[model samples]
Target chain A: MDSEYLGYAAGILTTVAFLPQAMQLIRTRQARDISLTWAATMTAGVFFWLCYGVAKQSVPMISANGITLLLLLVILFIKLRYQDSTDTGEK
Target chain B: MDSEYLGYAAGILTTVAFLPQAMQLIRTRQARDISLTWAATMTAGVFFWLCYGVAKQSVPMISANGITLLLLLVILFIKLRYQDSTDTGEK
Candidate 1:
């Protein structure tokens, strides 16, 4: 197999690996326990990863991390939005 | 920056990215809408990615994906356990 194929497989694996959490949060609308600090740090890291991918001209890395970043951001946003009123003390 | 440091940064970012969701679910004990199929596929993908990381001797990839796999697994397990029993129409 070619290196691109391997990269594609890696991209798919890493990107899709986050689907369950994203789907669950979206479906349930529950975001009380998510932490701002953790989310912020992760988001920053993802952004950097995206830049790294771009710097390396690696489409697989860019695409996969990009999609994963978007998915993760939504949950982070929801957590920020409803964390205070959820009464779950999750934040 | 050194390659090792770069890899370490990537690992930190990716590994901790899922913290919010994990913390939330564990705090709320709620897992009503997570899809078994999605979770299963993602878990499998993570496993493959882990193997890929290992084969490449990429500690950054391995460590990051490994931690992510654990976090995702916990959420998936909780979702499976209560997915059928919960009545939120999420599953």
Candidate 2:
């Protein structure tokens, strides 16, 4: 297989990995168990990957990280929102 | 900054992202909320990245993916173990 194809394959696999967790969290409205630190760190990491992708002009990295970053952001938002509710006993 | 440095930087950021979650899971023995699908998918994805790294002979990719794969495997193990105990009441 071509190197580019391999890169895309890897990207797709990793990028899609977040979907199940994100969907489950959205469906169940449960984010208290999810670590905010993990979400935040992963988001920052994905952002760096996006920057690296742009620097290298790599389509796979740019596209994959772009979508992954969005997903992580949503997760982060849910985590924070639910955490706040739990902490304040508002939920 | 050099492109190589950017790749390493990206790798480090993304790779280290898992540590917080892993440590939390280990310290708290809580894996009930972690999606098995996510763990499985990510493990597979990191494996592909490892393969891609080998094919491309990229040091950063190889090193980062290698370590990430191990961490994901541990996470998968914890998820499975806890999930089984929860299901069977063995824990």
Candidate 3:
């Protein structure tokens, strides 16, 4: 029961944490510091977490990972946009 | 069985994702794009995840969250150091 609370709390915290980062990218329009590798890996990772949640039938995980995956996709989209527009490299 | 593999893969990818960001920070020494809010929130979230892992007794969660926590702390520490030297403002 306690661990369930902890899981939910942890999931909520981690899930919401990306909001500011996504907002920051929008606000500053700076993706120079955000590595392409990082975004790609996180996207894959979060996607898998979502699958894990679905397989395990865990609501907190499903919701948390789902929301965060969406946020991460936004982040990746923004980062790539910036990359394509400004920076010139493999990225 | 399949989901277990997915879980580990997810954990590993997410855990290692921070590496590039950390390396970028180290290489560029640029904290301008790095947000204090992002760092702080992520740190708190990851710390909670670590607690959750301990509660759940999941090796993948524990190891992944633990290593990522250290990397995040490093990211936060470096960001703070840069903030102190170069920038002035709350957070």
lDDT of each: 0.67, 0.79, 0.82
Candidate 3, A40: how far from true, in Å? 0.8
Sort all candidates by DockQ, best to worst.
3, 2, 1
Clash totals, every prediction:
0, 0, 0
lDDT by residue for model 3 (B22-89), tens: 99878767665566887898899899889888988988778889999999998898888765544332
Fraction of native contacts in model 2?
A: 0.62
TM-scores of chain A across candidates: 0.76, 0.82, 0.85
What digit string (tens of lDDT, one per residue) describes model 3 on residues A14-81? 88889988888888676776789998999999999899989999887788899999989988988888
* Per-residue C-alpha lDDT of model 2 across residues B29-89, encoded as one tens digit per residue: 6575578998998898899889889999988889899989988888898888766443221
Q: Which candidate is the best by lDDT?
A: 3
Per-model TM-score of chain B: 0.75, 0.83, 0.84
- Candidate 2 residue pairs in clash (backbone atoms < 3 Å): none
lDDT (tens digit, per residue) of candidate 1 on A47-67: 777877777787876887899
CAPRI quality band, candidate 2: acceptable
Q: List pairs with backbone clashes in candidate 3.
A: none
What is the C-alpha lDDT profile of model 2 across A1-91, one tens digit per residue?
A: 6876766777888999888888877775656547788888788878888988899898877989999998889888888766644322111
TM-score of each: 0.70, 0.85, 0.87
Question: For every model in order, what is the iRMS?
Answer: 4.6, 5.1, 4.6
